[model samples]
Target: SALNLQLMSLTLFDVFGAALGVFVVLTVCKFVEEELSNINMPEMKGKEGRFQYTITDVKITELNLTHADLQFIPEVGLLFDVQNSSITLSFHRRILYWFFYDTGNINASAEGVNINTILNLIRDDDGRLKINNITCDARIDKMKAQFSGTLGRVYDFLASFLTSGMRFLLNQRICPALNHAALVHVNSMLETIPVRTEVDQYIGIDYSLIDDPVVTSRSLDMNFRGMFFDLSHQNDTLVNYAVDPVIREYDRMVYLALSEFFFDSGMFSYFTAGIFQMDIVNEKMPKDLEMLLRTTYFGAIMMLNPALVEAPLSLQLAVNSPPKTSIKTSGATVVMTAIVKVMVLPPGQPPVQLSSMTMVYTHIHTSFFYFFRILLDFFDSNIFKIFSNQSALESLALIPLQAPLKTMLQMSVVPLINNWTKRGVQIPLADGMDFIEEVVEYHNGFIVIGANLHFSKGLREMISVMPPPHMAVYVEPTEALPYDSDITD
Candidate 1:
């Protein structure tokens, strides 16, 4: 029980500049700037002696994230430092000048923004990424305003008082807006990661976190359930009985290690759901193979039906059990037991079985390393190219169907399985995040995938150009932006 039975481990290595920076500069960080821009500042009202006035319709009209940097706080979470940003806003000003009332519009602008946020990350009770709390500190450096619509000279006199009040009120709204977005909106996005979800009608996957993520000075490590279930039979789950997958290398942006349990569970689910069965008809089979099938089953067909001898041949294959995945330093192998049936179908009649054969189809699973399969050799069906150092399959089938059956499997059933697996499984990722530069390394009983992470365009594209990560730019909590950080930043 004390052993670390981690089936899958995901790591964000210590030096997370590219993807993380891009994400901060593109998605979440960009979202922060937007939250600041969309801030709904409260109205400002004051009375100077007999002159009283109110500033309403207070809203930011423009903002820019000139320069932003993200840093880890060791024991804490992330610190988003938003620097020198440009912001602009507009408001409706109504003044009661000793009973003589007048209304006008005041457009305000500020330069050199100052905002910092701390986001605390933790695993929730349900095993999803959760934001514990968010602390935001924000302000506007220097704000100025222009008045119009009936207040010419009077607007000049009240500019200092009016701008100061608007700037302070706007500053007060910044933290709440940013904090709400992180705790509510951004957390909602993280929640999109499936804890346990149906992959397809036949099977389901559980990517629930095994424990709280380990945050250290070097990296962030997360362990996951990495299990699957047969949807047809809810309890048809493969035990997490494989060796723990270990991640020793932290050279990439993301490092993923999956135990045999992660892959075996899926194979088991499909097998239990009866999805590992396929019927290859002559139409999809090659001409030469179809001819060989016809000749090979001719005698059996004659014995079954005297008049219906020219029926089209069909090869049905079903994996008899869940595939066993074995991984070693040399490579990995998928050992499977399958029953293949040779049949002939008359025009409208049901399939008439000719000869039933058991194929221990063993071929190298590409993902688990280059070890071979089990059904191919046991069925006396010698197919698939042998890899370096692996033993060759000894052909022992005297039925003169080994080569043809091999061809038939490759041509028809293989594609079917590929399509089925494509739709029934996924690599457990949320929207816009993808795995890249993936390198699969096989160990004793598990696989480690070293990869770089890629995040897509954030927010939307704008025509404005942004400086580099180190180059201080500008940020404002004022309005909508016209720049796409993913473009040039």
Candidate 2:
């Protein structure tokens, strides 16, 4: 009986404790709900009349409230504890209010006012705004108003700093490297030379001939002299005689001899035969040669003219002349003698028989010689040494600068701006606190980097609506009211 009584008492005590706990929970929940209701109710008569309220915290038990109650609770805050709660009804009301009330009035009154004007009006004096723009209906306005004051300025500043840094890095490093690569490729192409070749056929001959002696035995001698020769043989008589005719005749013979010697030795004859052969072989050859010679000869001429070679016919005639000689014989014995002569032809002016040939050869040779001379001078001069040193210095400068610049641009500048822009972030006002923490982070502290970015599409849209700097605006803030009626009536 004692054991049963003790067990029954323990059970009753446990049941009472459970009941007390439930009562306390219910009382606390009621108090919290009442407090939230009062805080969320707007004062329609005061200066805060235009302001709305949002609830950030509530117990999970109150999630089943109607749409009217949910309007004052932020969707994120409402769903904090409650699962499967309907937050869509509250969001739709907020969007509807934004379109009908705020947007409609701004559009009707400000004829020329665009999205930018609204943005500017709402922005703080320092150009910072916590909630840039709202896009919800009346039910969600309470949540939107919670962000209205100036709490989001910090995030905006952070995003702007990162974006500016990104742009700076790209300009400093990436652009230069790309430009250098292109320049290097162009220089390499310019330094190379294309190759070409030409072939030509040259023919030459050497000949020797021996003469047979057949008419050596049949020879006779005869002598004759002028009758005036004995009188002219006296020294005084010969001195008195006029010798101008003989002198003139002797000069003519000497001139003839010189001409014959040049022709036989293949000097003038070689040049003449070349022109004749070129004219016969191909009409084009002479014209082309003439044009080349003219161009080259317009400059300076050189010493050696390689183009003037003896023709085959001229060579044959020269060889034949050596063997066949005219001889005067007295009786059976024969007198023999041989005379040999050589002729030289130097490069000359135009209109000369071999002018084109000489000029062409001289010009080509001179150009080659000039080029070699310049090359030698370059190696010998101080300028060449300076150029070599400068080239080395330039390469050294470029190599070190290139890597750092590329790193800063791609890792910091480009990523910061591009990522933030992609995420729809806005530029913060210049209030001296643009640098935000953890906006950008790097891995290996060297190669790869990461960034956190936020973007404002509304801000971008507003900026686009504004006209360029050249345009001016005319407005009067103190204009008289159109309605004179008193509202108290």
**Clash totals for all models, in order?**
25, 19
Candidate 2 — what's its lDDT? 0.19
342-429 in candidate 2: lDDT tens per residue? 1122335222122111100000010101211110000010110001122454334334333332333233333432331122111112
Off by over 4 Å in 2: 1-159, 174-179, 195-489
| Predicted structure with the largest lDDT when compared to the true one | 1
Q: What is the lDDT of candidate 1?
A: 0.67
Model 1, span 277-377: residue lDDT tens: 97777567578876665555345445567655777777677887888877777766767777766677878888786666677666554453222111111
Question: What is candidate 1's CA lDDT for residue 442?
Answer: 78
Error of 2 at 270 (Å): 15
- Please report, as a residue range, the 10-residue window in candidate 2 with the lowest summed lDDT: 3-12
Best by TM-score: 1
lDDT of each: 0.67, 0.19
Candidate 2 accuracy as TM-score: 0.13
